[model samples]
Target: MARLTILLVVLVAAMATAFAPVPLSRTVSTTALNGQTRVEVKIGEGEPIESALRRFKREVNKSGHLMDLRHKRYFENSQDRKKRKIVQARIRKRLERMNARRMRQRRS
Candidate 1:
């Protein structure tokens, strides 16, 4: 009886997963100067195209492919790349400091 019950439970779980509804994913491929990258977004059944497009844009931004493509569009010398990185780091640090100051003021 115990084995039969366990088998029935396992069978039910398998069937449930097998019949589960999976969202359809659409892939958008972008070709960069270096190579190609793909971003995928899932669209649920009956979902509107506008929302799906928004989701796709979010995914692409999160993946950094668009920014990467822009960066790769131009060839930068090593010295220029290093200078850009330094400037970015400085800006990032300044923003972090500003945020910290804001947090301190809020606590007070």
Candidate 2:
């Protein structure tokens, strides 16, 4: 009878845990200061601290946190923004041409 009670308790606990709603992903908390953004990662059970930190950094990078901070660091007038955009487009075109040339040379 005592063994039966213990077994029942164990099964109940297991069912409770199994039916609990699981979070899809760990929460990412961000803080910004002095034009830089910092990310805090909560390490999960059995997760290495270094691996968690690395993953957090990767997530931040993929989300453009650093790029956003960089763009926000200085005020840009409309003219300046336009000029920068033009320069970037030119540079992009130049790079594409160079890459195409390299590819053609490689094919020869």
Candidate 3:
């Protein structure tokens, strides 16, 4: 009986871990040239788009924001600007995907 109880407990623990929800965070990368730099950010799952984006926008626009173009003159380079645009597009796409996922989850 003791062994059976232990086995049941172990099984439950394993199941919980296996089915646990995974929370993901945003990823950002940055590089600089002689006069300009580039930054990239990738968002992950876990929260609604509005909240995640609000956090992102706040951080990006903050005075010390790592990717701030004005603060980081090196990032003002044309190449760096292009990379920033690409990263921004990725962020928007991620938001759309997140919304779709949430809707599907709600339906189920």
Residues 4-94, model 3: lDDT tens digits: 9999998998888556654456554455567554454456755577876776666555534454645466537788778878998999999
lDDT of 1 by residue, 2-50 (tens): 9999999988988885566554655444444547677766676788989
Provide the lDDT at 88 for model 1.
Answer: 87
Q: What is the TM-score of each predicted model, taking all chains together?
A: 0.60, 0.44, 0.31
> Model 3 segments beyond 4 Å from truth?
1-75
Off by over 4 Å in 1: 1-35
Ranking by lDDT: 2, 1, 3
**Residue pairs in clash, model 3:** 35-74, 36-74, 36-75, 37-74, 37-75
lDDT of 2 by residue, 1-108 (tens): 999999999889888855666553465667778966677677778777788888798878876777766776999889988998899899999999999999999999
TM-score of model 2 (CA atoms):
0.44
* Superposition error at 17 for model 3 (Å): 56
Could you tell me the lDDT of residue 65 within candidate 1? 72
List residue ranges in candidate 2 displaced over 4 A.
Answer: 1-65
Can you rank all candidates by TM-score, best first?
1, 2, 3
